[model samples]
Target: MQRTLQPGQRCEVWIAGVTGESELVFTSDELLLEAPNWTLDGSALILNGDGKLWNFDVAGRTLSQVPLAGIPDLNNDHVLAPDGKQIFLSANDGHIYRAPLGGGAAERVTAVDGSFHFLHGVSPDGGELAYVGIDAGDFSQPGRLLTIPAGGGHSTLVDVGAGHCDGPEYSPDGKWLYLNTESFTSLPGHAQLARLRVDGTGFERLLDSETVDWFPHLSPDGDLASYIRFPHGTEGHPADLLVDVVLVSTGDWAAPLHTWPLFGGQGTLNVNSWSPDSARFAFVAYPLANTDSSKDHVRD
Candidate 1:
């Protein structure tokens, strides 16, 4: 399958099973949506498109826009709080904002200027936010993993010397923070999954391979971690790629337990989409027709 995506293309949502079959949950008219975050109650999937947010009910198969009174330039780096009541959104203005999940005016959470902040995950206790920060003036510079008070306050740098990093998610127990980092500034850089203490200690790589890995989301039970893998030498994560959703035992990261092949990348598994019970996950796959053959299996 060709791995290239264009604007205004078609897409679909899928609820992936652990050992059985995958089911189509919703389909979009255009490629406007990116990243599907399962609602706390698992009743609906929240997605973003063209700077706006919408919620699609799984049972009713309906869609509704999530009202944002003043914020317009929203990105895919938004995540719902652990409590499932508030949402933290990353805007184009280089600031993160918090707002009610249902819909309302978003309040700025980061006070930084001339920089971009992309939210990745919220702490399980709903008190802190983990994200990747990039210097707006230098696109070549690697992004830094940072955290801040969920209520809005000064941010603290966690990955001090890493050249590039992305997808900073918190573990359920709140003891460790997981992310992907590319240590070089050159093109076709190799990226690998890693984790560190919440206080920025005991940093180590969890999974390293030739294929560039991004966005490692730990299950609610912290027993398994799933991430998207871009083909080797892929410059950056782009949509419509023949990517693999690799699932690994959190207790043993040496090998993936199962790999699901699909015709989607980037938005496919950017956020934590595991169900409350950790039995399944929600992911967005582009162009409904190509997903019929996408299935899961243990790697050879």
Candidate 2:
């Protein structure tokens, strides 16, 4: 089902410094904008809104719809290619596609049967893609991590553990794939940040935290990282709840360098939005008016 803004709610796009406060870059009282992918040039953020793609200009604080032909409504799991000229899309149709960032018809990339693909990461060399696959389009089942040739081919499974995992993205050097998984604990829906070698070995938890961590996005320099933290016991990253966008050192995920509190979850930080220089990152917040009773879910 399509996501909708709650009554009297608004969407806010923000840019945060690694060690300073967050700046509101843009806002919309109606449009529901999801995951932002920072352009490699650092001038704009590409986002998905109203089932289409858009480029949110950082300087002008404006939006331009990306003309993508021959594709279904997109999900928040879109990823920018390492080349910067192309983007990989995960559509609601349960397939993936590759398209020019400058705008054109998207070429279908995922042809595998029996599962729905949710793209998360592109390899540093742009030769591969990392994504989560839901068997037979079943949202209730745990997503399995898989990789395939960027141009489309047979996928290879890269298992982390039994519980569900998401936001599998490659490090700058391409040596590791960072993600959030529930493999570390028996507690239901207790996802934590972790990583694994690209060769499918050396799986390690990046942090031990009480909050539910999802989407570990590394900066271009691989020195800094960002992720969204849900309150403890939250079953999956849902929308309209209060959450935190955290920045941390790649060397120490357990120690946060900064955290921005807001009212958002699912589409908030679903993809990497770190600027090319790694000084700042982008995220979205969906805040409802004070009168909305849903605000009661804000964690204490």
Candidate 3:
């Protein structure tokens, strides 16, 4: 069944039942915000706006603020360990940091000084971390996906192809890692999803589309994937980020089962969490009203 809203301005949550279409579970003015990132356990939702991490309980509908000490001048492109023990987030200086889920302090995990780097995703087993690194001088060359121990150790180069790669998420069973890779020479701003073998052999392209695809979050069953699509048409002006859920079969993305359209042209739509049954998902929307390079949270 499909869901169609009446085009209201409030942020709401919806879930699909065993039969019939999805129904509204809850709507809140205090909970949802710009760039909300959800925890992997699906019990709490995390929203990062105004430079802080806020946690909201889905079951209780309560809110708690997490102190992101030692993590200053950075954004919340982060992932929680499957056991809900640690969080791996990126810094504006191009490094990855690991912090306890209880929210006290963070420790630096990767160091690529004079270069820009960011963590794409963390392995569900909490054993390995996948990230992208590039030279500060050149931003066009394909970035490197480095797999290192979650507790901080030597890094292993996973892929070095000539395409920009970012936003990696691992399967629930810890067998496959999915990411977005793009090239500028042959394909300007095209984005596609590629699957990496965790056993250290290599990766294969799962879905290739001209639209800029990013943030592929896999469901608990590992049969479905949700992502954000920034189509190529809205260049220069703010790009309209489209949230989509796709069904996968035999390692191939079959079709986009559902999609949520964006209202503001230059804002980003965040896919932070997914329900345990894979019937519902949560995200934060920010509409960029204008262009300002200094502020990272501003949508326009």
Candidate 4:
């Protein structure tokens, strides 16, 4: 089975189980395809693209684009509200905004100065939002993973002075908050996975890898996690982002369950949301090529 969609066309979600047939949910036209998100109840879909947030009705096949006034470009990290009615996005300028999925003005949730905000993920309960914020300093220390109320309130700092932590994802049960930390002097990709309590204590190392392991997304039932693994060396420009799926229980990084090669080369993969049933996930491929308007492209 196949579906036809243009570059920005909104369509239904095609689902294929491990051994069953594929099915479509029949959604409205595509509103914005930049970053599409699925609601918790699977009734609605939210998308953020080209400086706009859009809501789509799966059954009605309708699209509503929300207006975000006074907002700059959106950061890569964004989360959906637990109730599936709101979209939470992070700004590079150290602020988070919440906009209704249907269509309305977005409001600010965080207002910390000199901080670089990145959206990690939402809690399972949807009552709190988890994010990573770095102090606007010399960029020589680790960022802080914080928990804030979904409705809007003061932010509570969870981790402090860890040096280089990035990409925080909550476990399906919300009992463990996992993040990646690194000690590299230049690259944030030189990081590993660590589990921390919700209250910010009892930190334990889950896996250590010479390469970078980022964008940890737990499956719906909490059995597995899918992430992108970039190798350690760069041949010409930068290392390619390789897709990898791992079993959570295998804390020992001796071997991974399955590994696949992404077609794009010399680029990074930015993964955020996973499918509701955990059958597949979505990610963006960023090419790190140095080019001009007219130049020959080669695979180096």
Leading candidate by lDDT: 2
Which scores better on TM-score, 1 or 2? 2
Q: TM-score for each prediction?
A: 0.90, 0.96, 0.75, 0.70
Please report the candidate that would top TM-score against the real structure: 2
Q: Which residue pairs in candidate 1 collide?
A: 3-240, 9-31
lDDT of each: 0.79, 0.90, 0.59, 0.56
Candidate 2 global Cα RMSD: 2.8
Off by over 4 Å in 1: 1-8, 184-187, 288-300
* 1-300 per-residue lDDT for model 4 (tens digits): 112233433323332232222334333343223334667676555555445565557568666666666566564457777676777887545678887756567788876566766777778888788877767843555677787787677778886345566667778788878776663325544666677878887787666566666556666777666555656642211323333323332344445554433322221223344567765444323222331211221111
Q: What is the TM-score (0 to 1) of candidate 2?
A: 0.96
Query: Higher-lDDT candidate among 1 and 3?
Result: 1
Clash count, predicted structure 4: 3
State in Å the error of residue 100, model 2: 1.0
Q: Relative to the unseen true structure, what is the C-alpha lDDT of residue 143 in candidate 1, on a scale of 0 to 100?
A: 86
Can you list the residue pairs that collide in candidate 3? Answer: 238-266, 288-299, 288-300, 289-300, 290-300
Put the candidates in lDDT order, highest first: 2, 1, 3, 4
The sequence of per-residue lDDT tens digits that candidate 1 reaches over residues 132-189 is 8888736688788888899888888885355588889999999989888876334455
Better of 3 and 4 by TM-score: 3
lDDT of 2 by residue, 1-300 (tens): 667787889988888887756778888888899999999888999999888999999999999999999999888989889879999999989999999998999998998698999999999999999999999999899989999999999999998988999999999999999999999999889999999999999999999999999999999999999999999999988998878888888888888888777889999999999999999898998887763322332222
lDDT of 3 by residue, 1-300 (tens): 111122333344443322223443345434334334456566876655445566778788876677778876555567676677777776666677887777889888876565565665777667888777777736655677778888877878775367777666677888877777764325665767677777645767767676666667777777666666666642221333333323334345645555544432221333336666665556544323342212332121
- 10 residues in a row with least lDDT, candidate 3: 291-300
Scanning candidate 1 in windows of ten residues, the lowest lDDT window is: 291-300
